[model samples]
Target: MCGIVTAVASQDVVPVLIEGLRKLEYRGYDSAGLAVLNGGLRRVRSTGRVAELAEAAAEVHAPVGIAHTRWATHGAPSERNAHPHVSGGLAVVHNGIIENFESIRARLSAAGYVFESETDTEAIAHLIQSKLREAGSLFEAVRLATAELTGAYAIGVLHETEPECAVVARRGSPLLLGIGEHGVYAASDTAALLQVTRNIVYLEDGDIAELTREDVRITDSAGQPVERATHVSSLSADAVELGIYRHYMQKEIFEQPQALANTLEIIGGGGLPIPQLFGADGPAVLGGVRQVLILACGTSYHSGLVARYWLESIAGIPCTVEIASEYRYRSSVPDPATLVIAISQSGETADTLAALKHATLLGMTRTLAICNVPESAIVREAALRFITRAGPEIGVASTKAFTTQLAALAVLTLTLARMSGHIAEDVEARHLAGLRHLPVAVQKVLELEPQIEQWAQRFAMKHHALFLGRGRHWPIAMEGALKLKEISYIHAEAYAAGELKHGPLALVDEDMPVIAVAPADELLEKLKSNLQEVRARGGELYVFADAGSEIPETDGVHILHMPEHYGMLSPVLHVIPLQLLSYHAALVKGTDVDKPRNLAKSVTVE
Candidate 1:
């Protein structure tokens, strides 16, 4: 998940580049760098944060430049491996991986080009420079060079010879051109360009654009000229600002109620949701879908896992949830009647996109994308999509995105249940009522944050944690464990409550903390027994129980009551405390809560 921002403007763009990189810091990067075409190509890089890079480039100024915040796909996170990789007069900053860089590097090496870095982007710089010798212009050279490269990439290239313009290309990764009065800019996300301009042109895959101060020219993958529509972005710069919250993670954790409310606003009129809420052709798609194959990764995968229970039990549809990365590589039977639901917070997740394509290649035509970003690649590729209204989730550890996704999936479940004649009218109305009241319920759960923060004080001293849940809440436990491990840097694992004695109980001890999600569902007694297993093993227990489960507090047991149980939607409420726990624990541990180590938001590379 690298970030790119390139500008060819009338005024000095160094400050713009630095500010853009600051906006993209939430994507998670190890190093930052920029190359400007002044009289000559001037470059600066830092193996630190963007603020440090800004300090290093304080005196540097240029009208045309390319900048990057690198996430280190091809090499170690060092200044030498940072972006704005140069070859002769050309400099390149890239997002996404170049899969065939080894062969390109080998050929460039044989051609007397010396390599200074171990990055695939370095090979790209060399290849583009070599092409410039034969091609007439920088844009032509970039287009020709990209044709030979393999894998996903969005790259911005600047040549000192072509000081008036910058060339940008997009393949599998996202790249947009910002049209401003004084300049044209290219960036990986709109957040980076929002400060300078709201007018944006989202480039299609394999489209290349040449940006100058006053003009932008586009060429498609086939080398034919084309035009892409420019739309005014609705997102303001303040959406990314951390107002009163200490970190983006904390801010996002508290924004869940509003996010869910916005996502479910279509059905807020006290009526059953129609399938068309998903897309224009949702009725036909849902009518043909006899089974579901849900594909997703990370937090999105946990959402899909939770959906498996809902789809099967509520809609009476057989469902299978697969981790996107593994699903793409393996051969499996594809059913045309099965709806392939690809879930992602940022719609650009590489594995999920690849798996969606793989399923399509196998002849599964009924595909739906449950995502947050409307312009993301997965949404464009899927036949139908439900865009969650969780606006601009800047935190690397997703909170609002996860809850909004659950809200969307719940609506999908009810729609399918109504279509399949699996639900009575009264039952459907009750489910609809629960969804209508979801935001209020979530807000009440958020009210318990202070108590959860106290629990986090205890958890911060421990290095290992185990999360347990039963039935549908099992995936909620999994999500809870993931959040703890992601932000708090704790070794956490989740298990179905019944599976504790099978193997995981061996690791439970007095020093280890066990967190359990105990909603007052049918499995309350069984989950209570699982907590007893942990208590019997001298494992310190922290339980987030329902209001009336009556799981009494005793020695070695700490219980924080949720506002209410929420029936089938309990997973939505249960996950909030876990998110708060992770956030507070990370705060106590002095870790980066928004940008966790060795992880990035929107995983664009394999």
Candidate 2:
């Protein structure tokens, strides 16, 4: 993933570009660079953070400029490989990969064009420079270059000959235009342009945009003019603010209750879900569905795994979950009656979008999206959408987004149950009551943090961890293990409690810490025996037990009891302490909880 911010303004725009890049640091980057068409072209590149790039370009200022923070793809992170790659009269900053760059590079080389860095992007800059003379306009040159390239890209181009204009294009990657009274801006996401304007126009896949100080013009791929509607954004600047918490991850961990409340706000009216919760024909779609298929990645995939349990057990529907990246590339049978749901926090995940498109192209059109951003590509592409109100999760590891997604999926389950005539009025009322009281249940779970922190202190020194659960909580165990490895740098793995006897038991020892999610569900007795399996092998056990689970702390076994057990909703409640544990473990180990190494907030490129 990479970040871009370009502006055509009457005032000096270097500060604005730097600030935009600063706001996008959560997306993850290794190098930062910027180019401005002041007199000719002034550019600076750094292999460090955005602050280093700002310090390097302190003396350079211009009315028109483009900046980029790059997460490496084609080459190592270095100043030479940074963006705003310049050749001849053109400078360009690009996000996403140019898959056929090697062939293009060879052809350009035969034509006497030289490359500065070993990057797929430098070839694009050279190609644009080569076409500028033939295409007549900067926008036309970009369009021509795009025709020759393959794969995803969102690029911002600067021309030395045209000092007042900035040209940008998008294909398979996200790009947006910001309309402001003082200037116009383009970026990879709205976070970069939010400070200047609330009004935005999201570009289609093959759209090209030209920006100047006073106006912006957009054209489709065929060189015909197109009009795009601009909408005002509801995201306030304060949603991304870290007021009292040490890091964004910690802040989001505590904001779970509020986020869940916002996601379930419509159901707080005390009735079954309306058809509009999904779409105008939601009830009909639910009634006609023969099966459920979930497409997602990362934490969202785990959430889908959890939803499989709910959809199958509560709604009596057969469910399947697939990793988005692999699903698109594999040959699979498509059932038209299957409800295909795409889950993503950013709604711009490249793999998930591609998978959804692939499924739709195969005639499986009953699609739905569970997303957080209303303006994201997945939301626009799906036939129906449910937007979670977990606003602006800045952490690389997801917390609030995952919980809010579960809350939305719970509503989806109830909706399907009602549509299938499986639940009566009183049963539906009880489920709604349990959902409305989720915030309070999560609050009680948060009360176990001090005790979990004690467990985390002991876990901080361990090198390996095993997470165990049974039935519906198995996915929760996987999520807990993922959080620990993602933030604390611990080697962690999860298995269904029954699978321990097959092969995982060999890894259990005094040094290997075993964490168990033990709810008071029917499987509690079986899970207790599994914990004894670990305890017999001298593995220290840390169990998150419900109040009536009868699990107690002794010698090598440690227990933190919950005040109550929430049936079918225990995953949402139990995940809270696991999040707290991961945060505290990362804190004790002195690791960066927000920007974990080798990870980005959104995986926008494949």
Candidate 3:
């Protein structure tokens, strides 16, 4: 993923673009560059963080600019690979990969276009310049240039001759217009443009935004300027502010209740019920008839795993979740009836977008997306959408968004069950009742702060940890381990209790804190047997358990009793302790929490 910011203003745009890049640094930090349209074309680029780029550009003065913080996709991270790739006085910062870059590069070479950086971004500037060679405006040239690319991209083009305008387009990456004082700003992350403008417009795929010093005119794929509505960005300055919180992970952990509540509000227990995958209704929605194939990267992939469970168990539909980076390069045969569900908080996740487009090319239509942000590239391709209400998760360890995704998916599960007739009256009533109680239960878990704070001491010295779960608790285990490793940077792994004998029993030493999810479900007896196995191995167990499950307190097993058994809701409660553990672990270790090293809040550049 990469970060892009384009600004056109009467006053200097260098400082504005620099600040935007700093805010959007999480998208990518491998390299950074800025190009400004002054009386002449002045460009600064470096193979480092945004700060390095700013340092390199310290003396340059420019009026309008386009900048990029790149996460390498087509080439290695080098000065030659940094963005603001220029050609014939045209500068551009691009997000997304051009699958046809090799072909385009060859064509341009034949056409005598000299290249500088070895990036897919360069070809666009060359092509735009070539188009401008004809009798077209800069916006027309950019439009023509972007149309030829055979892959996902959000590009911002600035020309020396056209100093007061920036032209941008998108296919499968996010791009936004930040309406500022007598000027316009554009960036891949709202964080970058937050200081410049709170009133923003998110650009859709195949949509073009021609930004001028005076105003921004946006248009559809067919060249008609459309009505540009303003989205008042709600991201609080404090939300992103680390403040007194030692790390973002800790801040986000405490924000879980509100985050989950926001997502619940979006899905709304009152919304139209979700339809089943398919059966008698002949697929009410196209996505219902289609097989469900999910694509995501990292933590979002974990969330997808939980979604698969909800979809199959609750909605009576089969589902598959795949890692995006691997799935993007595979030769696969997904059924034509399949629907691809692409999950990413930022919507600019490169590998996920590639996989989603690949599925579409293979004729797998009816895509549905569950994401947090509107106007992200992931939203454009989906036939149906559910925007997770988790606001601007800044932590690398993803506490709030993961919980909110579960909340949204759970609501969706109930909806699909209702639509497909799989939901019996008693079952539906019970599920709804359970869901209704979820918020209060989560609030209760939130109150266990004193207890959790005390428990954090156990992890301050541990180097390795294991998370255990059975059945649906399996995903919770995986999530727990992820939170620990992500923030604490501890070596952690999740294991299904049944797999203990298959392997992994060798590492269960006394020092290891084996966090287990032992809910008071039907699996309680089976899970109790598994915990016995861990006890036999001399493992120190930290269990978040229901009151029904007998607390095994022999030598090392200690239990943190939950409010009650939530059945499916247990996963939510089970997560609270894990979050606290990570928060405290990171706190003791003295690692940066809010902005974890090598991690950004949004992966907007792919």
Best by TM-score: 1
Off by over 4 Å in 1: 273-276
The lDDT for every candidate, in the order shown, is 0.93, 0.91, 0.77
Candidate 3 positional error at 166, Å: 2.3
Q: Tens digit of lDDT per residue, candidate 1, span 176-294?
A: 99999889999988999988999999999999999999999999977899999999998999998999998988889889999999899999676654654877788888885789999
The alpha-carbon lDDT assigned to residue 568 of candidate 1 equals 87
Query: Residue pairs in steric clash, candidate 2?
Result: none
Off by over 4 Å in 3: 46-61, 74-80, 106-116, 135-137, 217-239, 266-283, 286-295, 311-319, 322-341, 350-367, 424-427, 449-463, 511-513, 594-606
Against the hidden reference, what TM-scores do the models get?
Answer: 0.99, 0.98, 0.85
Q: Which digits, one per residue and each the tens of the lDDT, describe model 3 over residues 1-606?
A: 578889888787888989888777645367889988888788898886678888999988776889988777677888888888888778888887788988888999899998877788888888888899673788888777777888878888888787778888887777778898859989887888877778988877788888888888888777887876799998855667667876566677777777777666543454444442122232445434435788888778877887787778778878889998888677888687776778888676767877888888888776777788776767766667777777887666677777777776677677767666777877877777676667778888877777766666766678999888887778888888887777678889999877876787788879888888888887888878878888898988888888888876566977888888887667777887778877777777877655555665566444
Better candidate by TM-score, 1 or 2: 1
How does model 2 fare in lDDT?
0.91
**What tens-digit string does per-residue lDDT give for candidate 2 at 185-232?**
998878787888989998998999999999999998888999999989
CA-only RMSD, every prediction: 0.9, 1.2, 4.1
Question: In model 1, which residue pairs have backbone atoms overlapping below 3 Å?
Answer: none
- In model 1, the worst 10-residue window by lDDT is 268-277
